[model samples]
Target: MSVLSVFVPVLAASPAAVLVQATEPPAATPVQAPSTKTDKATDETPVIVVTARKSSVTNKIDRRVYDVAARPDAAFSSANDVLARIPSVTVDPRGRIALRGNSQVKVLVDGVEARPGVLNNLQASDIDHIEVMTNPSAQFSSDGSGGIINLVLKKKRKDGLNGIWSVRGDDDGRYSANANVSYKTGRWTANASVGVNRELTVTRTDGRQHWQTTSGLETTTGAGRSTTSPRSSYESASIAYDLSPKDRLQLSGNHYRPRALSKDAGTVLITDLSGVLDDHAESTVNPDRGEGGEITAHYTHTGAIKDEHFDLDITYGSSQSQESSTHRLSHTVPSQADQAYTYLNNGRDSSLTIKGDYERPFGTSRLTAGFQAEQNGSDARSRSENIAAIVPGEADIDTAFSYSRQNLAGYVTWQTPLGRWVVMPGLRIEADTWDAGAVKRNDLRFLPSLNMNRDLSDTTKLVASYSHRTQRPDVFQLNPRRIYWSRLYAYEGNPNLVSQDTDSYEIGYEFADKGFSSNGSLYYRVNKNPQTDTRRVTADQVVIQTVVNADQSRAAGLELTAKGKLMKKLDYSLNLNLFDSEVAGMVGGETLRRQNVTYSGNAIIDYKPRPKDWIQLTLSGEGRGVALQGYKTGYYRLDMTYRHKLTAKWTASVRAFDLLNTSKQTDIFVTPEGDSRTVSRKERPAIMIGIARSFGNTGQ
Candidate 1:
């Protein structure tokens, strides 16, 4: 019995070394009436083996962990292709992820929290492996300002059936297909999945602006081009149950639809005079849809208060949404304008959350405490119509609007570990209530946080942090419609807004071990009472622009990420982020400053050569710089993927998204309309391939 007992033959067939007598098992010789063990509750809390937590201790510094079932040569199909490997994480222009450069984050898959919450629901070949906490502890839910990207999803740690089925095709015009199914027994476990897609896009632009108005002077110049064809679709389903080992249950459903058709014609000059119509007769078509479902129950408990360990969760949910728009505007000075808008949003957001966490192991130290509570709600119905001159002596006008809102929040967190230092402290308090039948809005806010880390050994690490953040105003942008005439451009809704505060500072450095890792950070942000608005013009009045607090802004950044294993079957990753922000300008009193720069990134390379055999190359990108007035117009892109592992439970993959076909623009140049307008962004082209087969511990 050597070589660790022949490399652990189940720890030498341990039942405590047979006879189940490793130590203290012979003292259970007393029995009284009523015994049959079925719901035998007597402070019972055994069975603590875990699958979702991902075992293995200690991963100093950049702290890395990835077992996509031992890699399988991981070629990445989604789950953001394994989050493009952390560090400054970005996938903006609406592709999600947006970390260090901030796209107003917060995305979680397993622990819930995912929606049209600004980011489109999912598809990355139906994910697995995407965890970029970027210094998140204190029991999470800090509402991602550029941190936190969970997305776990992939289970069944043992006892039977596993699944996956795929079909993919691409060259960027878009096409896709998918399916996944699962099962596990031994206290129960279950899963299900489905998918579909489509795509086409193109765009171009040029501009110049200078203006001074009060019934005064103006000069504007422009250039234009556009082509967009889109038809996108998706579907989702989920179920999970494990009633022991600390209770768990879940149910989920989702659906999304996108339809687009556009042919652009542009030319408008107020002073220099330049007009040409029928660039496609200014045609536009768009349609969006949404559906939701949720029910969850989770619980965790541990005792020996003198040594602390506790966890808990309980949640309930409901949802609905629909949107419609029809527009046709041809103004080469002909007088035929057509517009139709329909928005019906129903709501039921419910919450009764009570979370508590306590952890203690103080010697070489570790201490933590956490708390949270939330309740949310919303309701909507708005209808608008306009027809100004349709061939005859035409005249038509109609308007109807309705809105409602309510929200509540509470938060607390603390952590400590001295001697080689590690400390975190937090506090959050928010209460916002609103009603717009033309008025009723209340506000309350308080936020604070601090973090510090030190461990100059085991592969170096040192970090620091300070935070305070807040932002609220969304839901038809506080629906108080100022103007709505869309076939493209002319959307305004602002109900006198308030609430935008931010203060941040950070310093960092981290280096990891084993397969290799790299980290870097530098951050600064300052914002206060920043909502912004001021746009006025008369003669019939279109006096738009709302949401004010008079600007004050600043942001700075730099980030980098790296990966390893150049051989041993090749694996690579590279990530980068760069940002510069400033806004403060006024021409009257003479005080000006405006600066913008943003660049986001992604890179990947994988090769198996053997094992299960695989091949891969991926590159993803986003860019923005040069913007003003609703600031849009920013673009850059690249994508490609290929995978093959035909046996050991079949596997296949193929993908192409925006592959060097970059186009995005969102509209600006409003020094009160000296003119140069027509902006739009958020277009997707997809191609996906699939074929999957797996069973039992596909989780390895």
Candidate 2:
């Protein structure tokens, strides 16, 4: 009897009958006679097979990887949009990114340091995945005290030609287009891409300040509206060649240009305990532009030994920016003379990096080592003039500044397995030199890291890690020249600022089954001599903002993530983070301390009604955040996208951003002598529609 026939009868029979039949022997069947002559031919049938899709998120012992290619909205999303959807990552209206309430985080592209504003110019479609390492190994640079984020670019290894073209536009006067093409033949591969984006934004701001004066209490209120239009374009090209079966070489270059124009108008009211002192009207206009470019060359060699390789890379980059502004202020209540101001500023910066790495395996152990050398230089010039002679000695001022730095680092790590546990230990040493006009300094530091992983079963694991990292002061923080914002406000950098150091530790548990995965982690971090911005009033009653080193700070947090399929046609991903933070520092000879508990989370739900249609919804938000002398209110955003495949080579999508129109930020500062509050709001809800076409093989 066939296996199916025997099991079917056993499953359908009663328990008593099945038990009796199982103990008895069956009778044999009679065989038929052999068939004659020729038998009729039969037609063949085709067979089909289905496989499960890969998960959008993967948790490793040391890091978390997010697959950008697996998301249906990647084709129409920007780098900022993608990052906002990730756990522990937050992006503000100004495009500033923070990780776990810390702004001192480093970002890299394909294992290399990227230039500032690079993320704003990148499209999500150009990236294959993103890696977040809260406690990085010593092999990586210790530039960021919080953590590191790496963007891995897509690679085309299959032969022949491939290309993609797309165009998108929104109802709020924004538009973008991108084109990419790649070709491979023999041992050579080449790729090129070009893109452009244009945006028009409007914003409104309101502020109120109160202070205790010698005579009585003084108050100031202001309201302002501004509009900005920015245009950006980027182009990149790369080529790779294989010299032999074990050797390869690659060369790549990219360039970007950005330009913007802005206008602002506002009204200010000043009052004492008695009555209104003055009513002032002000207006300003600004124009800004910048361009940057970089080139890189890389080489690799493979050894005969398993998992043995050597790699080398060299990169050089340069950038320049210029801005000019004009402002006018008038006292409407007193009918005083009008005051006018004009300012011009320009800056240029360049950087060079060289790196080499080697890895080898010995039996069940692996060793890795790397070295890096970096050099950076910058120059800035500014000119300010008060046409109305309102500020006396500050009428006409000219300033010039230059800064440079050099760094050399080396690191080594060894990984070994014992029973069901794996451990890796690493150390790095760095020597740095800084020069800024009259200021000079030299320092040496040693950093260490340890990571461990234990396998509990086929589908579960435990991991723990510890790392020591540092954050150096940037050029803007080291410059001593004053940059004026208005007659009543200015900003300056500290020449004696020092680097910040941090120690971080984390423990996590992860489990993965056929169609589900979850990860939870607990972490703590301590920072020494952290840098923070402070505000003070000068003898002339002008507000000055500057950076200073704080005594210390501490943070502890728990992070959780889960992703799986709810049914055959629905899937979802969720992330939640809860944290507590404490900061203590001295400002203007006053000791200040602040503490708070906060939380952040995001959720993504995807629904597939048909084979060629998809709908996705994403919700993300954060709780109140604490600052050195102030606090910032939290905000939430909701987004949705619908995508449909029109044909094998064409696709269309529509996306809505900030659907609830609740994206706003408020900041409050309290001090012994005064208090202030400010609110800022950007654009409202927006809808965008896009179309994309694919040509040639994508190698899927």
Candidate 3:
């Protein structure tokens, strides 16, 4: 076994003369500590720029590092806010993350998967750094067809006790408070963090749909307004002990609780050439609550064998959630009717994972091997009943389903260095077993990966990689149950769905000089059984939206990014990713294919007028592109922030999000039968002010 390489943390911005990267030349020798003796020249002239303004960017063999702790926006309360500031990363209106043009990404905290919404619970200030791995190696997990994102948390340093506390508030009635504390003694250290937040939000949506009927095309226009208030609390603690200089053990635990109260009201008008046929109004009240916790134990032993390393980790996690909603509908014209319904859902899941890895380095060559076994079990029950309605009611609307999944995987990788070129070859084998109620599936899969890097110059590198990956269907997706939102709309999962497989290849060039850095890559991917959301209209005029696996899909894209300083006092980062995708599949026994070209870009500019003041402006947008069953419109947003250090221990900041209020998301769906629907959603903008104070010194 061998240990992973230790790369210094660096920012991911383009190189700028005024903001140099923190990494040093591989051939550069290490410098010694300063001594008491001083030369006459040193005394006459002071070295002001000790290390190029403490660069926040670093480039790695397989990923780009972003030192969020070094950025002014790191103090944000949500991971969504922090990730939105990074180039090549996008956060959707629903808080989902997308890398490049793909959303099937895996997010980890300290090299392990945390609970859902964990990132939303995490305060940006607690993050030490983030690694964006576009192409992962064999040492990592085999999930996520898009990419991997790892968040490294801050640990305790030095001795004694030290901590930081912060409080924030916004005009929308959102407030948050956070505290982090660390204590270190000799060979033992403990770290803990807690955060609590309450958020209130309002949103509006309007859309029109045209349906092709036997007589003619009928139109329906609808408008909706929603208000939601959510409260969340998170806590994490860890303890580390060193048995020897080369042996260490650690235990960590995390817990998250979140609850939300929401209400939505909507009105719809249906008309045809004859005249307005019906006017309908609907209202819904929803309450959702969830709690999750994770416990992990890890042990690492280095130098157990000459040039060898060993690591072991085990984790257990569990979550429980429940949601209840009540809907009331009233209609005027075309036979007036009033209906009321109640929907209840309860879900619980648990996971266990055991992983062990070994690594050995021989001269310029390195070898790594790992084995992992994971088991996940979940139980879900949903029930719906009509309290008062004009439609017929069923007595057996309740349904319960249980799912269990097990995956056993092993992998081996070897890295060979020859002159200015390094080549890595890896193989992974996995056996997966899944059981969903009466349905069962088992599969044995083999995946291969290859990567090569060539040093073109002292400041440039050429890299290429290829890998085979799979995206398994989630538990919810494998359950065959109907979830109804209204009389006209319903959603359900497909029990016969299969996994999605992808073959990906990429070639890239990286260059860095002084403070400016840039990279570009071309990638092509082919997918089998690509899962996508689809829309269909039933004979009874009800629309059903569900996840379906497509026959085949292909995507080709180019990604370009640059970051660094524009001037001595100005810093900027930018990224552009463009792709063309095509999907061919059978819908309603008819083969259909659609092709689309899409792109997204992000630009950030920071200005420091004084040592104590920081101001930043960011613009981001995505171009219109194809959806699983239809297409989506393009959208953009603008945001700004200003921070001032009131004193050495105090800081104040203000931020404005979606200044233009144009960050709306729109999508249009068209079925093979000529049935079409359009949906548009927009969230209200927000302005926030925050204050923070820190005590003690943890060697920040």
- Top TM-score hit: 3
On residues 175-221, what C-alpha lDDT tens digit does candidate 2 reach at each position?
88988888999999998889998887788989888877776788888
Please identify model 3 stretches exceeding 4 Å from their true place: 1-22, 25-55, 214-216, 304-308, 335-337, 387-396, 698-700
- In terms of TM-score, how similar is model 1 to the real structure? 0.29
C-alpha lDDT values of all predictions? 0.53, 0.82, 0.81
TM-score of 3: 0.92
**Model 3 per-residue lDDT tens digits across residues 126-145:** 78788987777766776888
Best by lDDT: 2
Ranking by TM-score: 3, 2, 1
Instruction: State in Å the error of residue 663, model 1.
Output: 11
**Better by lDDT, candidate 3 or 2:** 2
Candidates' TM-scores? 0.29, 0.91, 0.92
Better of 1 and 2 by TM-score: 2
Rate residue 81 of model 3 by lDDT. 82
Which stretch of 10 consecutive residues in model 3 shows the poorest summed lDDT? Answer: 1-10
